[model samples]
Target: MNVKYKLNLDVYKDRNYESIIVAQNDDKSRIIECKLYADSQPVALSSSVTAAFNATVNNVIVAENVPCIVADNAVKITLAKSMLQLAGMMQCELVLSENDTILTTQHFSVFVNKSVINTKSKYEPTGANLATKNDVNSAIETASAKMIAKDSLLNTSTSINLTSLEDTEQIANGVTISVSNNKITLSGTSTAAVNFYLKLKRAVTLEQGKAYCLSLQNFANIANSGCVFYPANSQKVISSSWLLSEVSAFKNAVATYTATTSIIIDAIKVAIATDRIVDNACNLQIEQNNKSTAYANPDLIKSSIKPELYQAPDYTMHYLYVSNDYDEDTDGFGVTKFNSILSANDSITDNNYHNRYTIIVAQGTYTNLQDRYAGLSDVGLVSYRGVMMKDYVYYESENIYNPQATIIKWDGATGFDKSTLKSEDIIKKCPFHLDLNVHTHIKGFTFDCKNIRYALHLESGGTGYATNWVVANCIFKWGGRADCVDYADKTTVPVFGCGHSFGEVGLIENCKIIPTHCTIGYQNHDNADNSSFGLHMKTGSNITIRNCDFCGTEIQARTLKGAYSDTPNTVNIEKCINISEVKKMYSAPAERCDWKVTVDGNEVE
Candidate 1:
C-alpha cells in the first residue's frame, strides 16, 4: 500500500509531529501534503507565488531548493529515493515566495524508518563494526598520557646554589675566588685569559638534543667571560659555549644552549680574559625550557580552560564648563565651573590633553574672544545659550535647529587689513585655530562679527592640508558694509576663510550666513565688486556645504597666489537654499582654473 501523510503548517509557528514514518529506499510510495494557514484562515496562493521544500539530515542537506506543487493554500512534496536513503530523523521546511521575496517559512520534522523488506537496496546496511565506549575512552586516555609525559620532559626545572666558594679552583695562576653574601667574586690581576672551575654539589643530567636555560643571578663585570658545561667524569664540553654578554640580563642573566650528547653536568667552567677589578656571580639555575618556550602550568590549566566572566568597566564623561556667572576660584578640571572659554581651553595641557573634551558654554553673550588653539583630538564646542544644558547635550541636533542663544561678539574687521597682512597674521586674527589632522565639532553658537572680515577661520597647524573640520548649527552674521570702492577693503570679507593651505575635506552644514548686503557694489557683473562671499575656497581645496541658507552671500573660489597647478578645487553644494537675488552662486577665475561646482547632484557650469 502507498504511504501518504497529511499535516497542517502555520505561517508563524513551527510544527513537530509525533513521527512521520517513511521506509528507506521508498520514493513513489511516500507523499506529504501540507495545508498552510495564517491564524484561523487558510492562506490563498496567487499564480505568481511559488513554494520550495528542503530537508536536512544531521545538518547535511539531503534535498535542497526542490520545487513543490502548490494549489491554493495546500502544498504537496513527493519524496525522492535519494532523500530516504539513510534512515534517520529529518528537519524539513517550506518557503513560500513571490517574485523572489519570501512571504513565510514553516518548519517541521519527519522520521524515516529502516525497512527490513528492502534488503537488496543499495542503501542497505553493510554490518560493519563500530567503535565502543571502552575503545574511545582508552584512546583518549593514551593521548592524555602521551601529552603529559612530553610536557613534563620539556618544562622540568632545577636550581643549583653557588653561594659557597670552598671548592672553587682556578686553572690560571693570576686569578682568585672569594664568596660573600651568596655571591662568588673573581678578583685578580690577570692580563691573560683565566679559567675557573666550580664543582657542583650533586650531578644533574641533561638529555642530548634537548634545549636548556642557564640563568645566573646578581651577575656583574663579566662582559668578556665565556662559560662551558662539562660532564661528571670526563672533561669533555657537553653544551655549546656562550659569552655572558651575548645573553639577556636584567637583575639576572639567562642563556640557552642545546646539549650535543646526553651528559651529567658536574662542573661549570668560566673563562675570563683581560684585567678585571672584580667579577661577581651568584645563585644559578637551569631548566629544560627554552627562552621562547611556553607551556601551561598544571595549577593554571583548570582556570585557563574556563576563565572568569568578563564585565565592562564603568565610564564617566568629564566636561569643561564655561560660564560668566561662575566664580573664578572654581576654574579647574573635574569641576563644573569655568570663568571663560579661553580659560577652559588653556586648562587642557599635555598631561591631560589626549582626553575627549566637550566644552559647554552656558547661556550668555561672550565678548572676551581671542584666538584659541586646539591641537588635540575629540574636542567639541557646544553652546547651550537659549536651550537647556541637558537637552542640548542629549538632543543636540534637534535643539541646534532652533535659534542659537549663545553669541560670541567681536569686531574682527576693525584693524584687519588683508592686503598688507602676512599669511601667519591672517590665521592668528581668527578666534579658533584647529589642528588639521584632528576632528573638531562646533555647534549652536552664533558668531556676531561686528564688521569682522571673517566669522570663523580654519588654520592648518602647519600641515598645509585641512581635514575633519565640522561646523554645524550656527550663524555667521557680518554687521559691516558689503559694498566698497576699494576691492581690497575689509567690507568684502567672507564669513568663512581658510589659512595659507589647501583642504583635503571640510563640512559646513545646517548654518545660516547673514551678510549686511548681498552685492558688493552696483557693478554686479564685475566679479571683484560682487564678491560678497560666504566661504572662501582655496585652490585645490575640497569643501562640502549642505543644507545651509545663504541670505546675501556667494561661495567664492579663488586660487592662492602660489598654489599647486595640478590639483583642482572642488565645492559640493547639496540641498542648499540661496535666498538672495544673486543668479550665480559661486565665482571663479574665467581661465587657468580647473574648478568644479556641484548643486543638488548636478554640476553647475
Candidate 2:
C-alpha cells in the first residue's frame, strides 16, 4: 500500500529569528518558541532531520507536504496522508518500487491544538420553509421610506476664535492679534517680519500665493533662522512660501506679527502640540505629517500594546526611539555630523558590546553613509510608521549604471558592504525580522523622490507581505532628466509594479502612479511589461483597486500607459479615480474591469 502523511509545524519555535533545535535537555528535547533567536538570527526555520515544513504565526501550517527528511539513525519513517489514501484506494496492495523492491514508507501524523481555531455560530440560510418569499424585496425597499430618520453626519460643529493670537500676529501689515484663552484682542502692531518662515512659529496658516515676511531686527539671533509654513500635504521638507529649510525659518514669519492680519494655523498641529507638551509633558506625540493617524495622541498607548509575551535570546535591541531633534549639526562638506567621526562615532557593535537596549542619536544631518559603521549588527528599530526623526536609507531604485537616483529597483538583497553601501544595506541591518503583521501597511510610510524606482523591493523570503496589505491613499511622482539614453526613452516603468517576486496576495486600494514615455523596441508600447502600471496583479488574487487617484506626472503622451495594464491577472479594478487629461488614461485593464468612474459626483462617459 502506498503511504501518505501531512506535515504540520506550529508556531512553537523562533519564527522571527533563526530556528534551530537547541539542545535543552542535553539533546533529548529542544526549546521551541517564536522570537528566540530574532536579534542575531533574523530568518528562522523549523528543525527536522529530513523533513519539510511551512510555518505561520497562528494555527497549523503545512510542513514538508512534499518529501520526508531522512533521519539517518532515528529510523523514523514519515509518510504523507495523500500517499496512504492512495494506498487505501488500492485495497492494501503492497506498492513496489520501480526496481521491484519493497518500498517501506513511515507514515507520520501531525496533531494540532484544536483550541486555536476561532469558532463562529452557524445560522440557517434565507426564507422560511417551503421557500415562500412574500415579496421580501419590496418590503425591504419601502422600509426606509416608512421609517422616521434623521441624518446627523451631514452637520459638523465649528467655531472660530474671536481672540487674537499671542507671540506673533497677523499676516497682513499693521495688525497684531493676541489670545488669552478664548478672549481674542486686536492691536496696532506694524513692521511685521517679511520673512514668511518667521510667521508660522506660534500658530499660522500657510498661504500658497501670500508671502508673510519676518524682520530679524526685533528678534535676536536673526543670523541663521527663518519661519516655515508646512501645509498638510507636504511629504518631503519642502515648505510653502519661500520654501522653508528648517523649523526656525518655517516659524519665523509668524513669530513677529502685525495688528491687522491674523494667523490661520492648522487645527491638527495645535491639538498635537497641546496633547504632547501641554498635557502629557513627558510622553511623545508624533505630529510630523498629520495624514491618516491624524495627530494621534493615543491615551495609554502602552495598554493598547501587548506586553511582549516572549523574546529571543539573540534579540539584541532592548529599546527603540529616535531623538526629538535629529537634524542639526552638519560637516563642512555638508554630509552628516557623524561623518567627521575621526574615530568610531555611534556603535551597536563595540568592544565587549554586541548589542544594547537603547541607541540615542544626537541632532545632526547625515548623507551618503558609505560603509562607515562597519561592525554594527544585531539591532532592531521598532516604532510606528511616520516617526519622522529617523532617516533610514531605504533603497529607491536602480540608478541604471549610476545606482543612486530613484528608478527601476530590484528585490531586497541579503548582505552589503557597510563602507561600499547601496540602498539595500538598510534592510539587511535592521535587527529583527517581523512575525506579527498588521495589514495594509508596508514600510509604514511613503518615500518622495524624483522618479522613484521600485516601490517595495523585498527579496526572497520576504516578510511582512500578506493578505491584508493595503496600498492606498498615496501618490507617486517621477520626472525624466533632460539627458537620457535610448532604452529609457522607450521603456518607462509603472508607478507600482511587483515582478515575479512577491509573496503577497493583498489589495492595492487607492494608489496612483505616472508612467514614463515608451518607444518601440526600447520599451513595449501598449505593453504591460515596459510600464509597471499603477498596480501589479500577478501573484495572489482577492485584490481590488477601488477609489484610487492616479495621473501621469509627465506630459509626454506618445507612451501607452493608462490607469492599468492587461497582464491577464485575476483581480478587479472598480471605481478607479484617474486624474489624467488624456481620455485613454482612464481605462481599466482586467477581466472584471467594469469600471464605474465617478468624477466628484457625476458619472463619466
Candidate 3:
C-alpha cells in the first residue's frame, strides 16, 4: 500500500520519517510488534507497556503499542520512554477480516525524507448507498477541491465500495449529493436521476451539470452519531454517545465511514439490510404470551422514547376510522387518546404537521374511492384503529350533470344514502382521497369487516396525490371473500390483505393477517385468473414490513415491482411458531428462504 497525500512542503514544519504499526500473526487477539526503518540504529519498545501509560486507556478501540513518534531519524522508540506511555496506548484494530485475521497496514513511511504536506492521506471519500443529486454533487466538489490542494496523490482508478444503492450497479461519477432537512438531492448538468443510474454501469462517468436525481437511503449499524467532515487527513471517528445527545442505531452502524468516502445512499441501505441476519423469521421477535383471538395489547407498539428512534412506520399518519368523539373501551384510547394528547399544543398545523382531520368510515363496505367527500383533506397522521364496518353504503352516485356539485353527507362521504347510484358518489367521486399523508403512524387496532368486502381500501393515485400511509399492528381478516375486497358482489380483485399503492409510501408491518395473508384479485377476478397470495406488494413504493406474525396465512409473499416482500420464503410451517396454515397457490419471492431471519437470536417460531 502507498501513502496517498497531497504534496505540499509547507504543511509540515519538519519531519524525518513516519512509522505505521501492522499487526502480525504472532498474537491472535493482540499485536506484538511495531515496524520502522532508518539509516542505522533504530529505537523500539513493547506494545503492552505503552497501553499502561495512558490516562484513559479503556476508551480507545484500537490495538496496543500505537505509533508514538514521527522522528526524522528515530526509526523506533526507546523502550524506557515507550513503557511510560504503554497504559494510555492500549487499543484494538477492527479491519475487513479474511479468515478471521486483521488486514490494515500503514504505508508512506518514507515521507519523513520527502516533501509531503498531506502526510497521513488524501484518501477517497466513502460512498452513499443511494445518493440524491446534492449528495453526489457535494461529494464530487469536495473530492475535487481536496485533490487540487494536495498535489501528491496518484490519479489511480480505485474501486470505492458503496454498500447501499440497490437496482443500480454503482454510483455514477459527477452526481452531486447533499443532505438538507432530511432530504437528499442529486442533480447534474446533463443527466437526470434515471440517466445517472444508467451511466454508473460503465466506469462511473462523472457528469458536469447534467446529473439530476434524488433518493431516500438509510444507514444501519452506525455506532457513531456525528458526521466526519474529513476522513483523509485524520480518521478522527466519533463514537462517544455523550458527545452526541440523540444517537440512533442507524448512526451507530455507519460510524466507520467518514467524509473521506463518497455517499452512495442507495448502496448503504442495501448493505444495512445484509447486516441484519438471523435464521428465524424476525429481525427482532417478541411473543410474550399472545393468545388466539385476543384483543390487541396496549403495548403492541411500545416505546418510552418521545419520538421512536429507528422505528418503522416512522413518521406518517392516516385517519382514525373510529371517531375521537365516540366512546372508548375498545380503543383503550390507543391512537384516539394519543391524538388528543398530541393535539393539546397549538404549534402544529392540520396539514403541515399534526392534523385533527381524520377518516370516518360509515358502517358499510364499498369497492372504490368514488365518493367525492369520503376522504381526509391534507392531514398528517390520521388515527384509525379499532373500527368495525358492516352493511353500510353500496350506491355509486355520479353527477356529470354537475361536475362541480357539492355533496357533504353527515360529516363524511361514505354513509347510508338511500339515493340511486349516480355517475359520481360522494365517497368514490372525482378528487376523492384515500390517504391522510405525512407523519403518519397507526397502531393497535383491528378492523373486522363482518364478512363484507375487505375491511380497508385505498385508491391508487387519487388525482395523482402522493400517499404517506403507515398501517401498523392492525388486523384485516376474512379479506378474500366476495363481500370483502373491491366490491363486485362476486368480483375477486388482485387485492393484497392490505393493498394501497400508486406512489404510496405503504409501510405495513407487525400485524396479523388472519384467514389469509393477501390474496390476488377480489372474489370475482380470482375465478377469472385463479391465484392466492398471502401478500402482494407493488414496486417503487418505499415500503418496509417487518416483525409480523404470519402463522396460518394462506399465501406468504410476492413482489410486483421494486416493493419488497417482507415475508421470507421456504418457510417450514411445522417449525413456525403460532402460525399453522398458509396458502401460496402461486410462487413466492425469490431468495426468500436463503436469509436467516432472526431477532435477538430467537427464531420467530
Candidate 4:
C-alpha cells in the first residue's frame, strides 16, 4: 500500500564509490526507473531496456528488479571513476514514469570529497612571454620552493669564525679584517660600511686576543652571514686554538638565537598583518617594543656583585600591596583598601615610563568607611487613618491629600492619624568607590558591600576612561544597589547608573559574584525586559568572562543590550558556569544590531 526507499552516495575524490538506490515494488519483473545525479546533474542510469540490474564498464552498478529477495526491495548503483572525479555533493533521484505518469520520487544528499591536488593538467601554455601561463606556473612553483626553504633555514643554525677562511673574498662586502699571531681583528672602512647589518645592530664584534663570548649579539651576525667566514692574514689565523673555539661557540649561539628570533618575529608580523593577534599568544619576556641595547660587558653579568644599598626606584613598575596585617596609619608598608590608594594624587610623575602598577589585595573583606557613615537613613512617618466623628471634620477636603496627617473635624471628628516608625536604621553601602585611572588590578579580596551600590564603579572621567582593568580571583557580594563592577561614561551622563553604561575591554575572570544579597532593583520592576541583570553588558567590546562563578536570584545572570552606537559590542563567555537559581544564563533580544555574545563557543541567539 505504501512505498519507502533510501539512497546513499559516499563519494571520495579520485576513488570509485558505490551508490545505493532502493525502492519498494512487490510485483514480479516490474520495470523500475533509476538514475544517479552528481551535484544535481544526471550521471548514470539503469542499463538495458528491461527490468534488470544496471551495469557500467569498470564503474560498478548493481540493480535488482521487482520480486527481489532483498528486504528493502533494493537496487545498488556503482559510480564510475569519471563521475567520482567531479568533486561535489551528489544527489540521487528515483522516479516511476510509466505511461508519462510518475508514481513516486525520492531524493538524497551525498557527501563528496574532492582531491586536495588535482593531478591532470587541463591547459598547455607553451609560448614564452612575460605574463604567459607557463610563467605563472613557474612563479607559483618558485614561491612554494622558497616557502619550504625559509622554514628549513629558520629551524637550523650554524656559526663560523675567521680561523680557517683563506682570504677576505669569503667575507661579506665592506668588512675589513686581519688575522695574525693566532688572533682575528675586525675593523671597517666606515662605521656603517660593513655589511654585518644584523651583528652590527647589536655591536657584537671580535677584539684582537680578547676571550670570545657566546651571546645573542653574535647570533645575529652568524644568521646574517649564514656562518660563512674569511681570514685576511695567513700567519695570525691560528686555525685551531682556545680563543678560536670560543669564537666558534659564540657564533653558534648567535645563529640559534637569531634564527629563533626571526621565526618568532615572522609569526608576530603575520598575526599583526591579519589583525587577529588577539587569538595568538605573544611572549613579551623575549623582546619588548623593539628596544634593545648591547651589553657593555658580558663578564660583569656573569660575575657576582654586591647588592646595592640604595636601589633607585623603577618608575616603569609600581607595586602597592594592601593587606590587613599593616594599618593604614601606623605602618607605611601596607594599606587596608585598594580604592584609598587610587584616590591619592599621582606620585610617580615620569612621562617616559610604561608603568604596570599591581595592587595585590590580601585575603579579607574590605568595607568602605565612607559608605557606612554617609549612607541613606531610614527614619520616616508611617501611614495615617481617619477617625469617624459625630459632626463634619475641619479638613481640606477638595485638594488636600496627606496620608500621614491626623484629621480633626468640627464636632470631635478626626480626619487622619500619623505615627513615626523605623525599621532599617541604615542601609549598607559599598565601602570604597573606585573611579579607575590607571591600568589597575583588584585580586584576592572579598568586597563585602552588603547594602551598598557598587563595589567598583569604573566610570569614565575622574582622570579618564578606565582601560585594561581586571578583576580576578575575587569575591564581590552583598551589594545593595547595583553590580559589583559598573561602567558609565562621564561625558554625557556624569553619574553612574545601573541600567545602561559603556566600557572597553573589561575582563572578569576566575571571580565570584553572589547576587542573592544585591539590591538589583528588580522588586517593583515586574517586567522581565526592564529588570536588572547581575552582569549587565549595556555597552562594551572585548569584555571576556572566563572561568567565573556567577550566582544570582534574578531573572538572568547577564544581559547584552549592546552599545549606543551601531558598532558591535562583543562579549566572550568561555569555561563559565551559571550556579544560580535562574535557569536562563543570558537574555538578549534578537532585534538589536551589532551586539554579539558568545557562550562556551557558539554565539548566543
lDDT of 1 at 43: 66
RMSD of 3: 25.8
| Model 3 residue 357 CA deviation in Å | 7.9
Q: Among all windows of ten consecutive residues in candidate 4, which has the lowest summed lDDT? A: 264-273
Model 4, 373: alpha-carbon shift in Å?
Answer: 3.0
Please provide, for model 4 over 520-576, each residue's C-alpha lDDT reduced to its tens digit, 9 standing for 90 to 100: 311100012222332343334345668866554221223334223234455567787
For residues 312-351, write the lDDT of model 3, one tens digit per residue: 1211222222222334563323532222212211122443
* Clash count, one per candidate: 1, 78, 162, 14
Q: Candidate 1: where is the Cα deviation over 4 Å?
A: 1-318, 329-336, 351-354, 370-399, 412-428, 461-466, 481-490, 499-503, 517-540, 561-567, 579-591
For this target, which candidate reaches the highest TM-score against the unseen true structure?
1
Of the pair 1 and 4, which is ahead by TM-score?
1
Winner by lDDT between candidate 3 and candidate 2: 3
Candidate RMSDs in order: 33.0, 27.0, 25.8, 32.5
- By TM-score, the candidates rank as 1, 4, 2, 3
The collision pairs in model 1 are: 413-452
Cα lDDT tens digits, model 1, 1-605, are 01112374321135332332332233233456676654445666688888787765432356767899888668877667666654543456667778987665554456554452344643333211111332222222221112122322233232212112223435365667654322455656666766666644323556788776665543444352433222222244454454333134432345667777765664555556556433444434455656553111101111111113421112112345566666846423334346566666555542122234456566567766532322211113232111111111211111243336677776533344534333223223444544434445677778775433346655443343434566788887765422222433455555675542344466788888877633321011111111122225443556678888877566654442333424555667888787332223223444333446677778766
- What is each predicted model's overall lDDT from 0 to 1? 0.47, 0.25, 0.26, 0.28
Every model's TM-score: 0.36, 0.26, 0.24, 0.31
